[model samples]
Target: MNAVGVDVGGTKIAAGVVTPEGKILDEVRYPTPHSPGTLVETIARAITEVGDAPEVGGVCLAVPGLVLAQENKVVYSPNLRAVEGIPLKDELEPKIGMPLTVENDGNAAAWGEFRFGVGSEADHLVFVTLGTGIGGGVITHGILMRGAQGSGGELGHVTIQATGPRCACGNHGCLEALASGTAIGRRARELAVEHPDSALGRLAARRQILGEDVTELAREGDEVALSVLDEAGRWLGVGLAGFINIFNPEVVAVGGGVMEAEELVLEAARKEVILRARPPSRDLADVKVATLGPKSGVLGAAALARDASSREYLLGG
Candidate 1:
């Protein structure tokens, strides 16, 4: 079967026609609009463009915010402020002329990974996307754990340091503040300024050094970059240790732009978790990099549509 999946990010809206096996057939992209109405229209247009084929079953939207699944509204999203409280499902269903499902982008990604990626073998899983900020999703017993308010798995917001750096959410020392890609880049840039003779400095001179640049530089034997990554990895490990203790999931899948330095990042994180987390929980949970990469969000959205349809069929039967 075919479905359209829309990934609504802060900067762009990407929609694709996907097969049941998670292969994308066709995709369309557009810059995200600043206004709520324009944004909805943009999404609708993209969905229509991608889902015009006769075989398309439905459309699924992956949104980066506190998604109220019951009402199909985005309750709170700092990145997409204009869309807060908008009735996304009600608006997009008629526009696309098909059944529709909406879910948190991270949750969609978790389900995607469960259905088609590395987590396919695991019944209980947690997916952490360490991008501009951190996003998380949890799956238990083959079901997505969207809490009562549809905002349960805000893992990044978990406090790592009681009196640490301030976060955008008005919290102290959130995992996002300490270990996210943006945090890693910001720290690398700061260190680059101090170590002008370092390779990191040279990379920064050519262009703004991103988190992946730091990891690549570190692999090439740059001390400053390695130091920064190691520090970030340790912080990530601390957070993951807590997660392991609490949930004891079967697998922890890490993704996002920063994960390009898989070994550099995961090794340090693994070391910390191994040292800190409870023995059996850490051992039982296999930590791996997300195999789906950037396509995860769209694929996850498509998976959401697929799963929803399957449930409907079962219920009707």
Candidate 2:
């Protein structure tokens, strides 16, 4: 069977046809629109394009923020201002003419990794995407954990410092405030300004220095970039340590653009987790990088639809 997976992100909308084996067949992409209506229309177009294929069974949408399952409404999305309370499934299902499922993008990505990627070997899994901010998902006993209000597993918002920098969420000292890709980029830019002679500064002079550039600089042994990544990784570890105590997942899969820094980031994060997390929990969890890359969200969304269809068929019989 096959499903169409839509990854509705802040900057882009990626849709793909995914088989039961978790392979993405054909894909389409478009820049995310400004308004809710346009966004939905864009998604509908992508689904139509992908579902034109013969084997497509359903559509799965991976959305950022809290989605109310009962109403299929996106309760709040920090990145997309126009999407709040929108009946996403109701709007898209008819347009696409297929059974549809909506999931938190992080949850979908985590499930994808669990079923097809790095976390497949572990029953308890946590996936943290270190993008502009951190997005997390947890799966225990092979089921997604959405919490009571469908707002659970928000690891990025977990407070690491009581009196730290202000977050976009209006909170102080949230993990996102300290360890997000945006935070990393912002800090790198600041350091570049301070140390105008730094190699990173030279790169920033030509164009806006991105988080990836910082990672590259660190890889090339630039001290400023290395220090920035270490600080960010330390904070990441601090947040994961708390999660380790609470969830005790068997595996923690880290992905996102920041993971490009590889050892530079992971080493510091590991150090912090070892120092802060409960010894048993820390020892139990194996931290690894996700292998699916940018396709994780779409692949996971498709998996959600495929799993839901199988379960429905089983129960119906």
Candidate 3:
């Protein structure tokens, strides 16, 4: 069986036709639209472009922000303003002529990784995507834990500092406020202005200093850039340490574009987790980079769709 998975991001929408075994048969990407209405149209167009495969049993979307899965509504998305409060599944299911499932992008990525990537063999794990923001999902006893409100694993919003920078969630010192791609970029830009002779400053002068730019500069042995990532990683570790103490999962997978920095981020996070997390919990869980890379979200969404389709087919038979 096959299904369509759409990963909706702030700047791009990636869709893929995937098989039951987690193979992506085909894929396409398009720039995200600014209009809410057009955004829906763009998603439909993405599905169409990917091919209307007869084997496709359903369609699934991995959307950012607080997703009310049962209602098929995106309660809020900081990056994509237009999707907030929209009944995305209701809007797209009919147009695409398929049953649909909606999930939080973070949860979808975690699910993808758990079923097909690094945590495939683990019965308990946590998945964190350190991208534009820190999105996370938790799984325990072979079940995805969505709290009473269906927003249980929002690890990014967990407060790491009582008086740090502001977060998109309107809170201060959340993990995302300190460790996300946006936070790294913001800090790098500030350091650039402060230390005009630094490599980060030089790159800022040439153009905008995005989080990836900082990581690239750090790779070249730039002091300011290196420090920026180090700080971000330390904060990431601090946040994970808390999670370790709380959930004590067997494994934790960290993925997203920013993780390309590898050692610079993981090393610091590991060091901090060791320093902060309680003994056995810290020792029990291993924090590793996600193997699925950037495709986790779409792949996870596809997995969900395929599973649901399989259940329906079995019931009908």
Candidate 4:
């Protein structure tokens, strides 16, 4: 049997029919709607489109928000404002005519990595997705640690610098503010303005200098761009070092669109982790790039639905 996975992101919503072993059988994507009700309908549409298989057992949604899992509600989502305080599962299940599971997007990605990606063999792992903002998921003894209210894995909001720049979360010096894609873009713009004659500056003058632009320019040996990435990488390393000392996970997988630069970021993070992470724990876990790529969120959601179905079946529901 297959399960349906829906990844509701800030800019887009994606869905896929996933085999039990994590293979995606089919997938579809749509632009995210701005209205709460419309977004829910869009998600349902995506689910229906991808989960057309006769054997699909259940559906799961990976939401980018502070999901109140027990209530199937989205308490808050800075990126997707429409979902705020919405009873998503309640609204969608009847429309879709299936059992539903709701989970935090970071947790979903982590679950995907735990079950089928880079951390498949690890008993303890941490997964961080660094994009427009940072998202986090943690697994210990093969079980997700959602805390009492399902808000446990918010690693991006963790403070890396006490007096650094302000984060979108309204906090000062969060890991997200320092190392996320937004942060990279912001820094690149700043550097470009400071050095108007440089490559980054010339590029910024032509159009908006995005995080991808910074990375590309760095790869082409632009000094200003390299400096921005290096700064972001160091902050990422600091955050990873903190996670290493605290959780002591066996593996840590980092992913997200910003990671397109790959070794440009991970190499710096590893170097800093080696410098700051506590002794044996530092040596215990190997931080690696997430191999699942963009499919992690949907696959994880599918895994969530699959697990829910198995539990219901075992209980004779």
Candidate number of the best TM-score: 4
> Regarding lDDT, does 1 or 2 come out ahead?
1
- Per-model C-alpha lDDT, please? 0.88, 0.87, 0.88, 0.91
Query: What is the per-residue lDDT of model 4 for residues 1-317, given as tens digits with 9 covering 90 to 100?
Result: 79999999999999999998899999999999989879989999999888778799899899998988899788989999998988887898998988898899999999999888999889889999999999989988777878998888999999999999999989999999999999999999998999999999999899999999998999999999888988898899999999999899999899998899888888888999999999899999798899899899999999889886576434422
User: Per-residue lDDT tens digits of candidate 2, residues 70-119?
Assistant: 57677888898777877888898889899887888888888889888989
Candidate 1 residues lying further than 4 Å off, grouped into runs, are: 202-208, 312-317
Residue 239, model 1: lDDT of 93
lDDT of 2: 0.87
User: Residue 117: error of model 1 in Å?
Assistant: 0.6
lDDT (tens digit, per residue) of candidate 3 on 1-317? 78888999999999999887899999999999989999999999998777477688788899888888778888888889998887877888788888888888898888889878998889788999998889989877766777876667899999999999999999999999999999999999999999889998988888998999998999999999999999999999999998889888889899988899988999999999999999898999899999999899989889878765565423421
Top-lDDT structure, candidate number: 4
Taking all chains together, each candidate's TM-score versus the true structure is 0.93, 0.94, 0.92, 0.96
Better model by lDDT, 1 or 3? 3
TM-score for candidate 2, residues paired by index? 0.94
State model 1's lDDT: 0.88
